[model samples]
Target: MSAPRLRRVAVLVLDGAKPLDVGIPAQVFSTRGSMPYEVRVCGAAPGLVAGGDGLSYHVAHGLEALEWAESVFVPGYRHPDRDDPPPAVVDALCAAHARGARLAAISTGAFALAATGLLDGRRATTHWHYTRALAAKYPKVRVDENVLFVDEGRMLTSAGAASGIDLCLHVLRGDLGVAASNHTARRLVAAPYRSGGQAQYVPRSLPEPVGERFAATREWALHRLDGPLTVRTLARHAAVSPRTFSRRFVEDTGYTPMQWVLRARVDLARELLERSGHSVERIAAETGLGTGANLRAHFQQILGTTPSEYRRTFAKGE
Candidate 1:
């Protein structure tokens, strides 16, 4: 059979856009040509769109790009506090969304999506720093900064900066499959996956001192999910007392030590289920969830589905 058609992606660039937000879907989706996506940069009227830090990007397409796109991505912009996308942009977004085009807004791009009322009464997110503003500005929209991304069917939103990559990879995983998404991730030198429900903010407000060791500890944990880990053990690794570690860990990462570990194990289990032919019990043991029973329970609690169901949803070829 001939190769399947590539999906068209329109990256909507606004003034004061962040380069990474626009670059992410382009790079992550098209990097390996495994599940290649056709990425086009478009703007309100097309020409020169300003980016962060006095940089300017040229756009060869305009609003017309949305007409043929299978998905549209709104990159983060700097003026989310007050700026609104021109009426034309909002109207096109609504039309495209109504026609079943998947819509994703990165960081403050959610502000534009919210302005169009597309996210009304739907759970969504933006940069953690502006989630409050988003909630206040659009009371009907449920803003959740805690998640890396919110997959509300056709409309999606992601937290600040790097989370855009997470959302893009999710789209790839759902549209393509495990092996394809993993290929893209490997080409980009990024972690294979981060689940959408992963926490975006700390469990509590953090002091500067606690912030220093927080990320290092989490990176350390990501490599050790297959091992037995406890809050006390994590405390030892961080050189803090158990109580201090628990408090600081929650304050800095928004997840308890056990909660974080559970998510990590479940996420790893998902990848293995998608990529490998291993039995659920074997996968569970490998990911350190102890048994298939435990894995099923955690998947139900954290992911709202069973392991077998998840495997069926994302396993192997699409």
Candidate 2:
């Protein structure tokens, strides 16, 4: 028997939409192999769609195009301070979701989708810069500021500009398979996936001085990721009791000491995997993950892929 045909994806373009975000979903999803998607750009009106940069594009399809799509993607726009989307646009999105079409919002486009009330009580995310505004404007929606995107079943919301690509690749991976998604990423020269919970580019507030004890101890731990360092050793390095150091580290970094260490070790492992040709076992040992099996476990848990696969996909060019 033959495989099913590719799904149809409609990229809903609006007046004042950012061209880059508008193009990402269509570009990524359309490159997934012979059974590639059919991508159509549709506007709320019947003609040219004005872009964020004061340019206009001729859109051949109109709102009717969305009715036939299996999924609909709405890209970010520049003037989100204005609450009103054309009634036509809102109605089309509402109609699409009602008919069971998956709805996706890229960056500030979450504003458009949220305007429809379909995202109420559902987890979503948008650009880190506008997270507060999104939450304030749409109180019923659950906004997660840290994630690259949220896949709340029927609806999806992505973080800033580049994260749109990440969200599209994620959809491809989920709908197709890892190999298909990786192939699309290679074609686009993009990351295969960045989990939804990954931090957005929010600027960290300056850390408070947690006394000299906490400061010295974090530095000491940073230098010893390959060693068997624990909270007890960290407290000693800080010349403080373990209890004090644990509380101070959490206050300073917004994560517990062990959480910070694990993140650091994973980062170290990623660096080694990308910059060097070391086997997973060697990189695992160097990063204090102990064994390749343990490293693979953490890699899959945190990165959503095996270490070897990450290396194959993201390692320095051949």
lDDT of 2 at 281: 94
Highest TM-score scorer: 2
Q: Give each model's whole-structure lDDT.
A: 0.82, 0.82
Candidate 2 segments whose C-alpha is farther than 4 A from its true place: 1-4, 31-35, 195-200, 206-318
TM-score of each: 0.63, 0.64
Q: Give me the displacement of residue 45 in model 2, in angstroms.
A: 1.2
Q: Give the C-alpha miss distance for residue 243 in model 2, angstroms.
A: 24
lDDT of 1 by residue, 185-222 (tens): 88778778654343313322222333556677777987
**Roughly what TM-score does model 1 have, to 2 decimal places?**
0.63
Residue pairs whose backbone atoms clash in candidate 1: 202-254, 203-254
Clashing pairs in 2: none
